[model samples]
Target: MGRPLIHRSPMPGLGLSMGITLTMLSLVVLLPIGALLLKGANYGLAGMWDTVNRPRVWAALYLSFRLSLFAALFN
Candidate 1:
């Protein structure tokens, strides 16, 4: 048997609200991630690996991580 209907919400415009929420979420979250993925694809796996493996990249990453850790500890 089908489930009994529950009480309906008194609120209106749920469809419009959901559309706006999805649009905002896609623009704010998905677009940048998609761009990053496209960039990585263009760079290719070996190129990305080489870039990350560079000494300067490693140093900068290490410094950033250390600074973030220090800030977190301070806070």
Candidate 2:
């Protein structure tokens, strides 16, 4: 034979699929994180740290971690 036959997938190729996946992930995940960082920068580092260090924030964070741990173990 002069040349061998090449096989093709029924679905869209890897490049197109990866591009869509990355675009969706950037919109859904990265944008919010970027906005949070931008807000923190505008707030000033000291103010952001003070806000995070408050008793209410500490308690909420602790509770969330505890609940997450319990849920993970239970599941």
Candidate 3:
């Protein structure tokens, strides 16, 4: 069955949903990650490698996934 034409949009599609999702991710996620990499490069490759492979970073990543999975399980 088809939907009623009167209830549907008549205007041409502007792809607004795609634009909104792209803009939100750029401002919130991409910018922070760009900044982090730039700052990390201030250190040479050896320092960068050491910083990334630290126990604290691994623990934080593990905790993030662990907590997220636990929350999902509860729901």
- In terms of TM-score, the best-performing candidate is 3
Expressed as tens digits, the lDDT of each residue in 1-75 for candidate 2 is 588877877775888988999999999999999998999998899989998999999999999999999999999
lDDT of 1 by residue, 1-75 (tens): 999999887888888999999999999999999998889888899988988899999999999999999999999
Residues 4-70 of candidate 3: C-alpha lDDT, one tens digit per residue: 6676565545578778899999999999999999998899789999987999999999999999999
For candidate 2, the lDDT comes to 0.94
TM-score of each prediction: 0.54, 0.65, 0.68
Q: State in Å the error of residue 61, model 1.
A: 0.8
Better of 1 and 2 by TM-score: 2
Candidate 2: misplaced stretches above 4 Å? 2-24
Clashes of 2: 0
The C-alpha lDDT values of all candidates are 0.93, 0.94, 0.90
Q: List where candidate 3 sits over 4 angstroms from the true fold.
A: 1-14, 72-75
Off by over 4 Å in 1: 1-33
Steric clashes per prediction:
0, 0, 0
Order of all candidates by TM-score, from best down to worst?
3, 2, 1
